[model samples]
Target: MFNIAYRMLGSVAEAEDVVQDAFLRWHGADQSKIATPPAWLTKVVTNLCLTRLSSARARREQYVGPWLPEPVPTADGALGPLETVEQRELVSLGVLVVLERLTPPERAVFVLREAFGHQHREIAEILDIDEAHSRQLHSRARRHVADARKRFPADRARHEEIVRRFLDATLRGDVKGLEQFLADDVVSWADGGGKVTAARRPIVGKAKVLRYMLGFQRRPELKEISAEIAEINGQPAWVLSWNHMTAVFVAEMEGERVAALRAILNPDKLRAVTNWRPV
Candidate 1:
């Protein structure tokens, strides 16, 4: 349920709240009257998420800067199985951000069909819609995310190696080394949620991104904050903390180069994964 809600809502706090609400509802309901427990609970959670998404979309309209998905720790498989590249991609921050382009129904259908391998008929049941509509929603959602999706390393060891090397290069201000790892049109987004300072807009282009990286590395405040690599959102990411600032850098890969770098600096978003020990 947490996995479904997290993927649906792109929020750890909200997903947890939705699960708790579902539990409360389940506890209050008469089990004897329920036909199927799993299906019943899934429907409840999915509907609850739809309600939240409606309001969340409104709030995000007024959000400061680019609103990125909350990064979650997946090293322990807490959310669900992430054994396949497709599974991990579905839960990635970049893909989640792209999913925001979809309507609530479309997002729900996509997550159910793609992440959970639910047939359109089952998805229709969960969302209280017909099979035809479910198929249409899934098709639309796939089109929206098709261009946004990027390939990433399936091997944890190789992924970690790239992340660590990227971190090392960035910290040392090795522009040449870092440039080699970035895609031609690479972009970076930072989500501080207005609580801390961050780039209000996405930094795009390889050269521009390199300049930003070099400039950010020169900050005196970051000197005391050592970077730690951890498995976040089913991939290795850089977790940096010093005083009140906490940020997670998730690299979206296209083959061997990073296609995008998501910097989640919002204090609220980091709570779930902040305590994660380095992998």
Candidate 2:
């Protein structure tokens, strides 16, 4: 249930609130009146998310800079065991950002169909719409995400190796080494949520990204921070802590090159990862 809410809302704090609210409503309801517990709970949580989405969309619109989904560590199986490439891809920061462009109904339909594996008919029942409408919503959501999606590498060993090399090269400001793993069109986005110093806009292109990496490595502040690797959102990411603030860096891969790099430096978003020990 928390997993469903997390995927729908993209904020751990909000999802926890939704789950608590659902429980309160469930406890007050007439038990005998509820026909199926699972369906009843799902409907309650999903609708709660839909209501939140109306406002969430507005918040993102006014967000200071490039907004990103809160990266949750998958080591605890909190987001469930994402064992398949498709499942991991769906939870990734890049894909979640794309899903943000979707309408509330479209997102709900997509999450139900792809993440939870619900049939069109079941999805319709959950959303309180006809089966045909469910299919339409799912189709639209898929089309919205299809163009931006990048499938996760099928082999875990190779994926880790690439990230390791990239991290090593990046820490040392090795441009040639960085180019080996990054694509020419690679883009980087940092989200500080207006609370800290960060790039106000996306930094695009391999050259610009490498410059940014090199510049960051030369920062006097880097000396105070400790860096370690963690599996976040089902992929390898760097967790850096300095001045009591946590930030994460992850590369969204496309075969041998990195399609994107996400730096989640938002103080609020870093809360979940701050205490997480690497797996």
Candidate 3:
């Protein structure tokens, strides 16, 4: 249920609320009539998410800076049992960003078919739509996401090694080391949600990204902050906190090269991640 809600809303807090609301309904429901608990729960959760998406889209439009999905610690299946790479990819920050472009119904269909392996018939029943429409929505969604994607290195060890050096370069303000890890077309995004300071827009290209990272080392307060590496949003990421301000930095890689960076500095988004102990 949390998995469905998280994929729907992209905000952990909102997902939790939706799940809580679903449970509240279940508590009041006539237990004897719920012959299939899982199906009943799924139907309720799906409908609730549909209603929430209507409002969520509005909130996102007003969101400050580049809005990023709330990062969840995934090493322990904290976001649910992501037992396969395909499952992990379904919740990736990049995929979530792409998924945001899809309409709510379309997104729901996509998640159902791709992430959960739901058939058109089951999806139609769950969404109260016919099988034909379900298939249409799924096709539309697949095109939208497929058109915008990347090929990250499948090697987790190499990916982690690159991220480690990237962080080290930032701390040392090592321009050369930073550039080496970053791809030529690297892009960086920061989400402060107007509650904190962050890049108002994406910083693109290797040079600009290098400058932005090196700038971090100039801050004396950063030296007082502790950094930890953990699997966030299904990738090795940095969780840093200083002066009550917390942020998560995760990257996209091509082979051994860092291709993109996402920094979530919004305190609201950081709430779900507060308990994440870095590996």
Candidate 4:
């Protein structure tokens, strides 16, 4: 339950708060009256998450620049036990950006069902809604998310091979090579939240994305930037650093090409990298 809340909220401290609150709510309840403690905990935590999500959406709308999720890196570079390899990749910055298109309730239902494996009945209890309404929301959310995401076969090895090629191309500044691996209409987005410099708009089209990458590589200050491969979301990704500053890049692959690139450079968004050290 703690892991579930932590992943959902992206804050250990906040997850702790939610967990404690849930337990407190159940403290005096009759033990026999609750058939399933886990389900009850999940309900409490998820409802709390929905509340947080609502407030977060309001704050992000007024945010100074592009907004990105708080990155979470484990020792093994994967989301914790609760998440599968596929879910991790599907929840990357690119996917999360698409999720922003859905309404708050839609997002909640999607995450609860698709990401967390909750059934409509479980989700209904969690969100405090009727079963039918939960089913409707889940269906709507799934459709929106499916439309937004590519239909890539779930092949981890293939995904890693593509990512490795991407890293090689990036490190070598092989614009042509990189271009060959990008989709014709590739898009790239950066989120710095105005705390650091980043693209204010999405870089659309393969040609523009190629030019942007080339230009970024040519920056005089970038000569000092160091990069490493790390697990981001659930797939291999690049982590760049200069002095104490850090940035993370995760790619979305389509076939043998890159469909989208997500770069997270905001210092405030790199809190999870605070303890990260260059290799």
Candidate 5:
């Protein structure tokens, strides 16, 4: 339940709060009347998460720049240990961003069904909706996400290989090689939330992305910008650091090339990564 909340809210502290609240509600209720304690607890927690998601969306609308999800490390920073394929996909910044397009309930339904393997009946009960309605919402959510995310059925190994090549190009400042690996329609989005210096608008097209990457390499302020391999959302990603500040950058791959790149530089958004030390 804590893990579920963490994934949904992208904040460990907030997840803990939601879990605690669920437990409190359980404690306040009569045990004899509940047939399934686990389900009841999940219901309470999911509802709390829904409320959090609602407020979070409102806040993000007023956010200074683009907004990205917080990145989480695997138990040992090794992707192999993260067992579930669905869990791995959920961590992808691209998938998370697409999830933001979903309404709160729709997102909750999708996560519960896709990540936890809950049936429609179970989801309906958790969300306090009819089973048929739950099914409809889930279907609608899946379609919308599918339309936005073209990198479905992720290939972890292929993604890792591409990321390694990208890292090599970045380290060597090979602008041409980097551009060759990006999709023509490639888009790079940075979320700094007005707190850090980042691209105020989305860098569109392969050419623009190439320019941005090269500019960063040439910038005096970014001279110290270095990248280290990190497991974000269960996929191999790069953690960008300049001096003491750090940001997580993850790519969404389409076939062998990167379709989109998400650079999360917002300090407020990086809270999840700050507490996650590689084991």
Candidate 6:
């Protein structure tokens, strides 16, 4: 239930709330009326997420900065079973960003069919739409995601090695060394939610990203920060803590290099992650 809601809304708090609402509804309903508990619960949860997405989109439109998805510690499979690279990518920071472009129904159809492997008939029943409409929605959603999705290495070991080296270079302030690991057109986005200082727009190009990262590292307030590499969304990410702020830096990899970087600095988004232990 959480995995479905998380993928649909891209907010852990919202997902949990939606799931709780579903539980309350289930408790009130007569147990004998539900022909299939899993299907009934899924339908309730999916509809709840669809309703939340409508309000969530409006909230994001008025959001202070780039509205990145809430980063969660997935090493414990808290978000669900990510047994395949495709499954993991569906919940990745970049893909979740792409999903924000989709409409509520489109996002629901896509997540249900792609992430959960539900047939069009099942998706249609869940969303209360026709099978033909479900197929159409899935097609459009798939194209939107496929076109924007970054290619990541399937080998977790290699991905971890790259992140370690990248973190080491970052801590040492080795700009030139770090440049070797970045793609030429790499872009970086920071979501501060107006609670802290962050880039209002994405930093584009390798040189620009390098400069921004170096400047961020030199911030006086962040000088005493603690940093570690941890698994987030099935990939190794840099988790930094300083003062009362916790930030997660996740890289979108293309082979051995990073094509993009997503930094989640919003206190609201990082609240659940502050005490998360690395796997």
Listed per model in order, the count of residue pairs whose N, CA or C atoms clash below 3 Å is 0, 0, 0, 0, 1, 0
Tens digit of per-residue lDDT, candidate 4, span 1-279: 665665566544566678888889889678689898888777777888767777877887887766666666654534554145466645565566667667767777777787778888878877878999988987887777674456333676788788888877876789878988899989898888887888888899998998888888777867787877776656667888886788888888778888888888877667666555642
lDDT of model 1 at position 43: 92
Q: List the global CA lDDT of all models.
A: 0.89, 0.87, 0.86, 0.73, 0.79, 0.88
Tens-place lDDT digits, model 2, residues 71-170: 8999788799888888887888877888888999999999989999889888888899999999999999999888556547778778888888888887
Clashing pairs in 5: 91-233
lDDT per residue, candidate 6, 189-209, as tens digits?
A: 999999988999999999999
Model 3 ranges off by over 4 Å? 147-149
Q: In candidate 6, which residue ranges exceed 4 Å CA deviation?
A: 277-279
**Residue 70 C-alpha lDDT in model 2:** 92
**TM-score for every candidate vs. truth?**
0.95, 0.96, 0.94, 0.85, 0.90, 0.96
RMSD of each: 1.7, 1.6, 1.8, 3.0, 2.6, 1.7
Which candidate wins on lDDT?
Answer: 1
Better of 1 and 3 by lDDT: 1
Question: Model 2 — TM-score against the truth?
Answer: 0.96
What's the candidate order when arranged by decreasing TM-score? 2, 6, 1, 3, 5, 4
Candidate 6 clashes between residue pairs 3 or more apart in a chain or in different chains = none
- 1-279 in candidate 1: lDDT tens per residue? 998999999999999999999999999999999999999998999999999999999999899988999999888997788888888878878789889989999999999999988899899998888999999999999998986665666676887898899999999999889999999999999998898799999999999999989988999977888688888887889988777567899988888898899999988888887666432
lDDT of 6 at 275: 62
